[model samples]
Target: MADSVAVEDPKFTLQEVLDTFKSCLSENKEVFLEHYVAGWLGLVRFMNSLGSVFSFIAKDAVNKIQILINHLNGENGAHYVTVQSMVKYELDNQLVDLTKRGSFPESGCRTLLRLHRALRWLELFLERLRTSTEESKTSVMCSEAYNESLSQHHAWIIRKAAGTAFWALPGRATFFDVMNVGTPEQVVAMLGDALPLISEVYQVTEDLYVQNNILDLP
Candidate 1:
């Protein structure tokens, strides 16, 4: 999952990413790790298309996605199928470093937690984008979303760097076009459809981590 990594398709629409997110949740509320990774793969591709400025953010996300991908493709992949199952398996086996970062650096629980936090940022950012008007600024929307969500978890240096990148964001119209989802009206409609699913997936994973007391894992 390098920054130069190629996604499944070069021109995938936001709808495809939405479909992946939609599939991430099972009928019984299990969040499929594979689908979750696939959804992130699409988002990372979108981030890469934005510009080199966001490469740092995309790289961190890619690294987390790779960790989950490794666990999903590993020998014990069956136990790592769903978020709930992965949490149970990893904790039961003491495979997670719940305190400070240690041997289990690639633990699925911790890896997903990082991505889970980012997902909140995405949810907030997209909501802002959906409600934005012609005079609205994508940079401001992105900055506001980051502040409300991801900024708290990030270090001072990371936050400063990310804030600078926000100012380099495209205008609202260009942002909507990059989504490849028809017109701005369509993009807003698409967001309306996609946000709830993303929120649900985020909540399920959040609740799982909170219950396991691994929500703040190092």
Candidate 2:
């Protein structure tokens, strides 16, 4: 099911990767970074669904996630042991290389930060979508999420691209339909189940970045 959805349909593939993350949370402490973070390839294809503008942002995020996944899957060295450990290891070793590979937002910290930041948007938007009654709008939810999460520090182009996506969002029915989930009620229930895991992952990453002072780089 996942394999078919992922191929022949790029957007569905990305969402599938995100769904994989949700599935992995069942592993908790046993979660392996290689599989956890290696899903970026699918996500990049998924973002490509909206349009070209998001391609750059999605690529950046995918690039960073892949780096972590590689280090974890590699041998001959202690890879990032935890989200917290990874942050410290990268920053302390100067692996981040932010501005001119020195200032801020090194590929590592910066890209994860994007996903971290987007989590808040997802929470807000999902919460809204959850309680949404009476002709709710995906565009509004998406826009609200972007404004709250991914917009402030991003370049104008990204902000504009994000905004464009929000506006381009399909209505609720179409949106839910694309999710390939069940009825609205069923979807909401599933979201309730899935969101906390997503939020936990986000919070874990956010705290790591903030404590490491790597939140603003890129």
Candidate 3:
């Protein structure tokens, strides 16, 4: 199932990735699980392209992505079509181990929360990158973004390791070039256009988790 949506083209741009996020949103505002996973897959590829320094983060994201993918392909997949439906299905079936991690390690609720949190980190980091000037340090911007978002949910060791990895990030020029989207000006414009969609997806998921009282699922 994952292979069907794998991005193999070298010409993959941030624009195409953002479009996946846009497609995730239906007219009724429900997020389609398939497109959501594809957006994250694009992001994981982007992180991998950055180099091995981000491999740990990318690997963790890949695991979560696969978990959701499996749910989408499972016999109960019909119930997992959208984020809202997945939440309702999982909670109604008591598939989620809300208070503590026990069985159902691959519950869509818990798995998506991890990705949801990571999305916040990306949202902040990209916003910082978008507004940055030529003199801005990418490492500093990344660390600051991490601290503001994902760090709160990470263990001390993971946070320490992630902080060390930030120092290895390429310069702003190289980073923008890796995006393969054109000039730095274009990168900023693309980010400006994309961040809101990312934020909306994050917010909608956040609200769902909060309303279900699963925000702090162990």
For candidate 1, lDDT tens digit of each residue in 122-163? Answer: 999989988889999999999999999989999999999999
Worst 10-residue stretch by lDDT in candidate 1? 1-10
lDDT of each: 0.89, 0.62, 0.89
Segments in model 2 whose C-alpha atoms lie over 4 Å from true places: 1-19, 22-32, 38-57, 73-78, 98-100, 103-107
The C-alpha local distance difference test score for the whole of candidate 1 amounts to 0.89
What is the C-alpha lDDT profile of model 3 across 116-170, one tens digit per residue?
9988989999999999999999999999999999899999999999999999999
Q: What is candidate 2's lDDT per residue for 62-140, written digit by digit as tens? A: 6666555555645512545445555666767777766554554434456566666766776778788877875988888
lDDT of 1 at 102: 98
Candidate 1 C-alpha error for residue 205, in Å: 0.9
Give model 1's TM-score versus the native structure. 0.96
